[model samples]
Target: MSSFAKPGSEEQELKWAWIWFKQFCAFHRRAVEREREFSADEVIAFLRSKRDANVPAWKRMKVIEGLIVFRESVQHRNPADLLPLRETMRGIVSIERAKSEGYDTIDDVVGKIDPKEPDAIQEFRRALRRGGMALRTERTYVGKLKNFMADRGLTCLADFERIGAADVEAHLTDLAVDGNVAPSTQNVSFHSLLKFFTLVLKREMGKIEAIRATKKPMTPTVLGPKEIAGVFEGLSGVHLTIAKL
Candidate 1:
């Protein structure tokens, strides 16, 4: 029934975090009505929802830090579990600051991408530009995220809040078992999803315990007779003598 966080300083922005959390609960959830208590999953979902809504990373960091402080001083729970989230938030802030690093942003992202894309996708591209990642990598990440959304019937990024580690595992497992994708392909999809969740969604993915893709057999790398002959064809004089020796 109680809906108030303890008084906190403006310097830390803990006050604003409480305000945001309450508003988030009222709008998206009934946690406030239930107990004003939220689990790590809910918090992750909330932060991701904020990212989906185009909320700045600094504000999300404030919520995370404030929640940690609240746990320590208010609920007296261990805040160790949230430390990784803090690190992730720091990376987000760093990425936002990286726009001025002088890598090509005018065309690499702002011009090449459709302006009609979702804000989350647009932000994902901006993050890639600031990170200086290859264009191939950006496309791969976006494609993988789209596949996940398709599988889940997710129409917009805002619904990404419902996705978590379980969904990630399920999708990868289906790709391996049902779709029968190659091991390397599934592996790329796995990394692509992980990076998207961590960097774009602003959430930490838990350990994946899904069935793995089968590895394909490979031929040995020893030089063939033709290749050996070709190599000797280019050698001459002292080099040929040394090769013969």
Candidate 2:
């Protein structure tokens, strides 16, 4: 676990960090010809972009830790190259705190966004990007939020602030009961909305406790050697010719 990391936080950090590293890889792929090396300068630029986009400071730090760990453990490269990014982020974080603008995830946010998000769900997209999530993630999350908003009638001129945990639970529950989505699909939808509400919409998720989608038991298809041979023996005439051909 990382220093000062809460219990189980390191796992969460790695999860979130992988999310960031993917972005780093994407950025690295775009800006350089050879993808053989992880550059601290490139990472610094990526972190700067995240800060500019208003990703929380703690989240960006996790991103750096992920890169460091990746270099040391996965890539078997020197982790020291990323130290500059850590120091640079430290100074920036200090400046943010001195200005009294450091926003903690635990702190309650008291404002709402344009609930409609009529401009192509840009706000949600921005939130995902700022969080250093990947482009595919942005697409999936945006799709999920759009479906949730449209289904729940948040399109236009509706009371969005009143949208709460009950509404979310109802939507997910409907997907399970009515839509008959697989358990994993329902989980994806749940998390998509969870992040949207908590990170993008700045609302508390409270507790999910929604009725989960139960996966039905599946039967395996198998044929014994005798069964296969009998089937082959039965294949005469055109079937046999087609099989041979």
Candidate 3:
């Protein structure tokens, strides 16, 4: 019997598998040409465009999900290159709309953007200082905020206005769960988000507790004598003159 006629046959399974594999390969190649890495924004934009171009929504959604997973793996290994690719993909997607069909490439995309839009990072930094965050705290918070934005495929910190309490919670949860950060570290992230929303975005965060309050077991204390001995042993080359201090 033919493969299509046998529902449980190995040949039938192989045929379906090959079909899916070919589809994935085709989408992957297209994504590669669009940019070196994929991001959530890029996936959404691509799916929207595909839908606009008459592709089925289900197919586009599946392809976008696969692309995101593949791109995230690449990002984990090489984050430095991933950011630019994400920006590039956003530009590409933006320029492909019906109103801007003639535009292509990063230069074209960036060139058309208005120069008057305020720089989000600089603005947020200014806001942070105005909100009385210490210089060191400002730097640390901005770094965390920037990384968070990048992870979520946001182009700027100003985009925090669009983010809700749930999004903030989810990000903090991921940092705790996936990042395996200490409670203190997670609390810092929580404060950073709270500040970004309340101070920079001038919005309120309602009833969200700081992640730091969730304490883990205390780290075991090292015996001081053993620590002192280890340090002293490492000073073997030094001439220790017995000086009465």
Candidate 4:
């Protein structure tokens, strides 16, 4: 008989078992490493020691049977292949560790934010629209109000109420001097602020006059030949012919 086929050779069986155990460890190490935290050498050594002692022959056979079952469960299985039970346990332990450490579930750190007072700008604009202001006029007023808040770093309407006409005048002057805005543009921005403070904030902007008004230059009107011909000729072709008849 060949050396491997010899029965009752305890040393040879132990050596064969160790070889199978090493192969199992290699496969289990790869599986454990996929989990990002498990140390393969430590896990393999620990499991191998446990399997060699205290585990009964029937249980060991069942574990080996499970390995065969697992291998057969895949698309391909080799009858000659042998696998150790500890590898499967290592995979299960890795999974359990990951779950225990809270890596498995989605974190709750980003809770829902409350929609409250910070939404005042939107509310104010809606109120203005409901109050029958034209779309363009409402847009202009809201835009200026936003600019005022941005310029002063104001957070709320209450914060804006503390500002006086002097602040408004200063803002307009800054737009004219530093921004180099035209007098008409400055006047538009000024009026937009005045209207928002008076209507939306319910603040009295008493005697707040516009800085300047630019009268657009009038240009003479001209007519094209087609327009002039259409005006002079009136109806044409079949209509004209029918009318004459």
Candidate 5:
């Protein structure tokens, strides 16, 4: 257990710091006897993996900071590089918070995007761009792919290997049945999975057979002349102008 000599709430921070430090060291297979040293790659992998876990974003951010604190205070290592990574994580958390608050500026959305996205997903995105896919299509495919991965607890490229055709089929089925997705959305999801498996992962998944969503064709409600006149009967000002259109 890690303890701070200082009193008050700082103790809790120190405890979490110790926990993160210990977990980091253990995950890397560094024995207690060895002076624990971490590289940038290790730092990034740890953070990315944790983001996919059930851990809350706030706590994950704290864990990053805690590790930095432990390294500087306890290990006495110069963690200058780690500082930026921590700040990057902070930016992600802030962006997510802003999104939840309904701030959807292009800058905000771009800032929230992970620069170091998983290799498979990033490659798929690149492929989409290279093929001149529409911006909406790219976003849809990437979003669906992410949703599929998140559903299976996959957080990184290594985890993609565990995915197979059956997994893809099952995911599509779930989207149609449980997710209540439309046929178009289900089709997009399927194409996204196929591209990910074929182009990015370079895996040979046979033809995927999954339950598809039925397209709910929207029946447009056309108002008769009387109904339209009634709708605008008592309208005036901007409302009347809009109704006239």
Candidate 6:
């Protein structure tokens, strides 16, 4: 058999195994007993537990590989039989590929784009439509809300509760000052979010003193008394009386 030990090197893999041994003990709530030796069954159980906890697939696989090394090199036990079942190994590889392609988690695939799937923004859109809101208005409101959630990683309805006026003010203020969006666009996002909170969610966010988008001052077009009288020159009978009135 080929040499299993690295030449001129201390058994580092065995040391790593010792580290994981303590962790595994703690995980199972077992007391640290020096005479205890881990079994393949415990390793499989640990991996199953990690899977249920949503531990990243890649990280869990590393734990398995580490245990295999620990069993073979330290305990002088053949761990080939202890390797993950073929189906489970395939599943981990699939998850890794999916993650690399940007589908890192279930939430990413389900709740990101499709807002009609019983998620936070989806529920808001449903309520808006039921209230007879225009289709375009619903899209605009939900689109901005999705952008808000995407920026902050707020993936669900529960995340909305953590939001306060200050958070909203900061987001809107960024749009006006940093994003440099037109005053009208800023106003639309601002009012849309306000309506979402008050009407759809039935949560009141009192008056917000957000940074107001700059608007050109309107100079009133006042007509002088002489200019007004000139307007009556073309009137007749009742029309003239009504104009005078």
lDDT of each: 0.75, 0.71, 0.56, 0.55, 0.76, 0.71
lDDT of 6 by residue, 1-245 (tens): 76786663446656766776667888888986644677767777887888899877777766776666666666767776666553476566555644665565533432334644537877776666456465567678888888777766788888888887877787888887877777888788888888778876688866677787775546899889998889888888999999898
Report the lDDT tens digits of candidate 1 across residue range 1-245: 87775565444555555665576676564665423556777678888988899988888888788777666655566878878898989877655644544334445533356778876677777777667676667788888877887897877768888889999999999998998888888888888888878777888988898788885757788988999888889999999888767
Clashes of 2: 0
The residue pairs that clash in candidate 4, if any, are: none
TM-score of each: 0.45, 0.49, 0.39, 0.36, 0.45, 0.40
For model 2, give the 10-residue run with minimal summed lDDT.
Answer: 102-111
Clashes of each: 0, 0, 0, 0, 0, 0
Model 1 CA deviation exceeding 4 Å by range: 1-105, 109-112, 215-245
Candidate 6: where are CA atoms >4 Å away? 1-118, 215-245
Candidate 1, residue 176: Cα displacement in angstroms equals 0.5
Q: Pick the candidate with the highest lDDT.
A: 5
Q: Rank the candidates by lDDT, best first.
A: 5, 1, 6, 2, 3, 4
**Clashing residue pairs in candidate 3, if any?**
none
How do the residues 2-37 of candidate 3 rate in per-residue lDDT, one tens digit apiece?
A: 335555654554444344334554644553232344
Please give the distance, in angstroms, between residue 141's alpha carbon in candidate 2 and its true position after superposition: 1.4
Q: Residue 45, candidate 4: how far off, in angstroms? A: 90
Q: Tens-digit lDDT track for model 2 on 1-245?
A: 63575789667756655666678878656542223576778888888888789997777887888888767655677878788878876656544543453233212111233455664366666676456565566668778878888888786324457788888899898999998888988888888888877776677876877889986757798988888778879899999878556
* Over 4 Å off, model 5: 1-115, 129-136, 225-245
TM-score of 1: 0.45
* Native RMSD of candidate 3 (Å): 23.9
Q: Evaluated with TM-score, which candidate comes out highest?
A: 2
After superposition on all CA atoms, what RMSD does each candidate show versus the true structure? 17.4, 14.2, 23.9, 26.6, 18.9, 22.1
After best superposition, candidate 2 residue 149: deviation in angstroms?
A: 1.5
Which scores greater on lDDT, model 1 or model 4? 1
